[model samples]
Target chain A: MKAPAIDKKVLYAYLEEIKDPEIPVLSIIDLGIVRDVVMNEEGELDVTITATYTGCPAMDMIAAAIRVEMHTLGFKKVNIRYAISPAWTTEWMSKEGKRKLKEYGIAAPDKRFSIPADGVECPRCNSVNTRLISEFGSTACKALYQCNDCMEPFDYFKCH
Target chain B: MSESLINYTLHLADNALILGQRNSEWCGHGPVLEQDIAITNISLDLIGQARSLYQYAAEKMNAAAGKEHPAVTEDTLAYYRTEREFKNCLLTEQPRGDWAQTVLRQFFFSTYQYYLYQQLQQYADTNLAAIAEKSLKEVSYHLRWSSEWVIRLGDGTDESNRRMKEAVNELWRYTGELFVPAPYEKELGIDPGSMQADWMKKVSAVFEEATLQVPEKIFMQTGGKTGVHSEHLGYILTELQYVQRTYPGCEW
Candidate 1:
């Protein structure tokens, strides 16, 4: 029997529903982990992803999730590939992803080239006067921070 | 799948794993929160690289031997290997004594890694080149971070200055072994010795800015490349391998 022809649009719709295991507020699509999805001549659906950090433990979960989503969508010939070149950067994060992060209480990364030593606005009060509690947060991709004004501690999505 | 290639990959994996394990000791014990997290991030990057290298090594070994040989995995390579089987440099296997020592050691190693990976990005082997390309960016940040700490601690205050000097003196001996490449390493990868001149220039510039002196002349340590490490590695492996050894194929 011939493999059912799966439309690229349907595959993308399914992918957009798979949320990041670490940050449930955003899907892999919003986080820019999904670099591209294409149906090749052989009809294999190839999904390319870039990791937020080299050691971001969520990578395994992300890959597994992608596989599960594709299988659910009736895609049998799905291959997940990693793109390490142009290494994943905070710049790839979508505008909607940044908004969701704030709503979820993790401070979005500031738009700066270097690791920002200061001016990490607190997710709680939107206070720009925040202090770095720790350079590392509960996860490798986040930094610990506290608001000087609100005194609320939160995670900052660290820029790579 | 060549033995030399497998060995070369193992060599890289071991260095990253050992050093990453060492740096992880500072997870929550750092003097301050920011630096603590920074060091751990460095640890994560190293271990991540080690995982990819080990996976590559295992896959290559499995392909070469077929079903006649037992399975080889990243865990087995890391947790089951004996002291003599590990091929990391002595600098990486050394103890993470103080914050200054940790920072200084990272500075030396990261500088070498930056140049090493830069060359690796252009290797004839595409897989190796890809790994290098990804890792080089992370190592670049590590080099800068450690370099700043060296300068800050060296020039900062009286006590910090004294400690930084002590760290510099103690770690300097191990620097020599990093440049000496094993025969297999040369065959499978670029000769590490070729990167020494560039490594020195970067190191010297950082040391100069740190207002610290590199010893005018010194004796270099060897043997880590040959799997002969200091007593420190034994203890390191004990902690590192404890879980996998105890559980036998334990998973997170």
Candidate 2:
């Protein structure tokens, strides 16, 4: 017996509904962790993902979430694979992702790979008057920043 | 599974694992809140690298099983291994003295790793190469962060300068083992000896900027690469492996 095939577009829609465990405001699709999703010849869904950094603890949670979602959607045998070659960079974060992060109180990473000399624009008051409190923030993928105007501390999605 | 390959892989894993553990000690005790988080983040990166390398080594160990070989997992490789079986460099196993000592040790090791990983990326082993490539980015960040700190501390206050200089002198001896090419490292195309000149050059440049003097003594320490480690490693393993040893097969 053969199982019906899943439309790739529909698959992404389901995956897009799954937000990042850390930054719940942004979905995996927006975070650029989901590299590829395709149906194998055996009717199994193969989902490829990349970790944000070398030892991100969120990777396991993301994998588990994907498996659960697939199973709930009747994907009896979904294969989740990790791709590490072309390492995930902040450049992969979508425009929508950046907006959502800002809306949720985190500054987005710039396109540049190096740390900015001044500081990322503060997410709280949208103030340019900010200083980097630390190169690393509450998480590995973020840096701590403080806005001089509003005097609010926030995390900035770091440029990997 | 090639025994030499497994050993070589463990060498890399042990260094990352032990160093990560040392850094993790500063989790909430960093000099400042932000730097505390920063060091811990770097610790996470190193620990993650260790896990990947250990997983690969465990796969190799299990694949070459005979009647005498036991089942291997990341946990087993990390916790079950005796102190005599660890192959990390001595520098990584040293006690994290003060902030200066910690940063200087990290600077030394990160500089070595930055060059080492660059070469390892081109090694014949694809998995090892991938791991190297992945780790290089994080290690580069570590190198940059620690380098800036070295210069800041060295050129900062008089007390800081004295402490930084003392740290440099004390930690310089442990650096020799990094460049000594072990038998397996050589076979795997890891020419550690060749990296020494570049490592020294990079260190010297940083030292020059920091306005600190590099120790004139060329005498070096060795032995960690071959599983013989300092007294510090035993204490580290005691705490690191405590949960695993106390409750075998423990999991969250």
Q: Which candidate has the highest DockQ of all?
A: 2
Clashes of each: 1, 0
| Per-residue alpha-carbon lDDT of candidate 1 for residues A17-89, written as tens digits (9 for 90 to 100) | 9999989999998888888898776667899998877788899899998888888766677898888766787
For the candidates in turn, chain A alone yields TM-scores of: 0.90, 0.94
Encode model 1's per-residue lDDT on B65-157: one tens digit a residue: 899999999889999999999999999999998999999999999999999999989888777788888888678778878998999999889
Please write out the lDDT profile of model 2 over residues B108-127, one tens digit for every residue: 99999999999989888888
* Top candidate when judged by lDDT against the true structure: 2
Write model 2 residue lDDT over A52-122, tens digit each, in one string: 88789999999999999989988888899888777788888899999999999998887652664455788
Name the regions of candidate 2 deviating beyond 4 angstroms: B66-70
Estimated TM-score for each candidate = 0.88, 0.95
